[model samples]
Target: MSGGLIGLSGLIILFVLLIIRIPVAFAMFAVGFAGIWVLRDLNSAMSLLASESFTIASSAELVVVPLFILMGNVASVTGMSARLYDAAYAIVGQIRGGLALATVLGCAGFAALSGSSVASALTMGKVSMDQMNRFDYDNRLSTGVVAAGGTLGILIPPSTGFVIYAILTQQSIGRLFLAGILPGLLLLSMFMLTVVLLCWLMPGFGPRGPKSTMREKGRKMAGALPVLLVVILTIGGIYGGLFSPVEASAVGAGLVILIGVLEGRLGFARFWEAAKSSIVTSATVMLILISAHLINPFLALTHIPTLIGEYLSALDVAPMVVLGLILLTYLVLGCFLEGFAMLVLTMPIFFPVITQLGMDPIWFGVLVVLTLEMGLISPPVGVNVFVVKSVATDVPLGRIFAGVMPFWIAMLVTLAILVAFPQIALILPNTMIE
Candidate 1:
């Protein structure tokens, strides 16, 4: 069979497996192994699989993922999230829809340390939900904001998604991390604006409260300063080139533990729980990586990427049109599949089209991360919505989905801006890397 035909067959089998409810990693590995055997040979394919698994697992750069995850877990265990919310609420909790806005801001801060959207949503949900309910904030808006805001975890510095993208595209991890900063902040600003505007336009949806006393505000700020310092020292160290990404993660994890210990938050039992959780999460990610290893090589052996690259170049369509089609594909697939699975399934095919259009890899990485953020909040399979819904049993899935629509639109507009002016995503990396 022709290599291109083999590639097409493999893709069809993959989608079939997914639709049948097969585990994504397993489905990819199974199809990838069979495709490799047909396209190459059994022995060569096994050898390739074994080597790729080790190479990916032992990559020094990949250490950043586990360490960053550990930092997040440690902070959660040590009660950093409450301090963050206290500060956020003191600043924004008096206005109409203020509690909802505080939830967004607090989630963004917590997300910086906790790179998982589910974790940020759950943690901030515990901290802010009651206060929002007390403040008469609409349930749909209150829950939706945290769920949507938590997605900033994947776009901010130290994001696992960015790390995976950097590895897949062979882009500089540091540059990808740098590239996400503005977009992340831009998204945060837009979300806050949405909250304010929504409250202004429909005052019945949100009611204002008396402002916090000066003493209360001062105490909240004081308690939150430690978290700010930790974030500044760790992220600043990386962007400043004082430490590599891996080293920055280590330092961040260590500092979280150090703070926990000094504050008496790191008891023996708590430390063990934190360590075990981190191990479990890290192991889960590694297993997925190992499974994806089998698939990536098989795709290469089938000459799929090159064939698609050639086909895309042959098309007379404008590059921007092709890019729109790819983005639309992500939006459609996102409604049913998790972001990681989506990345594994599509990267082999769409990445070729992207490179064929001569887009900057770093910019493209940010754009992809933003798309995944959308997937986390969109309905049916929206992971963050599920997480929030799990905690708030009264909030129907439909309302949570309804509430996220504005943020989704905001994300689309932000994407359009980045697409029109690549500099939004690329300028920092270009100037800073030199």
Candidate 2:
């Protein structure tokens, strides 16, 4: 068999492994190592595996992953996320569908620090679900909004999704991060609008929440101010060229830890728990990245990316048409694969086609990350939906999925808008300070 076909078979086997409930990192690692051994030699495979693991583990820029994760964990444990949610609820809870809007806003706020849909969903779900239920909101909308809103974590800055895309594509992490901001805010706005439309069409989906006086609202807002400042400073510092992405992540994580500790919100036990969670999450990401490095080289040895890119290049269709198809593939894959797995597996093939088509890597990265966000709430394997379900145990899985449908459509709309006007993502990246 040709090396390409052998590579193809290895990929199929990898998916089969994944289907059998093997961990993604292990599945990729096993397939990639075996592919190298078969296509090259055992010595070459061993060398690549060892070198790649060390490279991934030792890379300084990758420190952003653990630091950002630490930020999220600290925020979750210290009640910073709860305060953010309470602030949004105070500001928006009184209007029809206001609680849902607050949920989206809260999710957005937490996304800035957390950079994780699961964390965002878990934190926001715990904070907002009971309040929505108390307001007699529909279970579907309440859970759905949390699931959908949590997806903002991947679209916003400090996003692990953006970080992964940057590392895979060799794009600038800061520029990729900048690229996500406008698009993220746009998606956040669209989600809020979706809630408005739903409430207008069916008032029962999200009932009006109790009103908050200005004094009460001020208190909630005041409570969130410290953490909010951390978001502003970390993101702004990145934007203004004051800090590298890794440095920004460190500053953000440090600020959260300091703020939490000083306020007695993160006591010794909680602090240790947050740090442990961050380490575990970071280790998992490092493993996935290392496996990706191994698999990418094996695929290179097979010339599969070249084979596919050449075929796509010879096509007569406009590049945008091809881009649309690539995104459509992502949308379909969203129902099955986790975002990181899809990114690490497909970027070697698709990103080459992208550059060959004369597309901006930063623009494509934003688009790809946005597509990953959609997967977080897509059914059957909507990771964020399931995360929400874990916290909202009384809400049916089907109901959570149903609730997220409108927001999913909103994501589609946002993607379409960005595709039509690439500037939405590129403007900030293009104008970046450094």
User: Top lDDT: which candidate number?
Assistant: 2
lDDT string for model 1 (1-434, tens) is: 78778888888888888778887778888888888888778997798788878888899988988888888888888888889988988998888887888888888888788677777888888888788778777887888887888898998887889888877767788898899999998999889988888889889666886799999999999998988888899888988999988899999999988998998988988888888988887877776677777887777777777776677677898998888878898988888788888876678778877886888878888989999999999878888998888878898889889888888888888888888888988889999897
What's the lDDT of the predicted structure labeled candidate 1?
A: 0.84
RMSDs, each prediction? 1.7, 1.0
Which pairs, if any, clash in model 1? Answer: none
Model 2 Cα lDDT, one tens digit per residue, 313-421: 8889999889998999999998889899999999988998998888999998888988998999988889998889899888888888899999999999999999999
TM-score of each: 0.95, 0.98
Instruction: At residue 375, give the lDDT of candidate 1.
Output: 93
Q: Write down the lDDT of every candidate, Cα atoms only.
A: 0.84, 0.91
Least accurate stretch of 10 residues (summed lDDT) in model 1? 284-293
Best by TM-score: 2
- For every model in order, what is the number of clashing pairs? 0, 0
> What is candidate 1's TM-score against the reference?
0.95
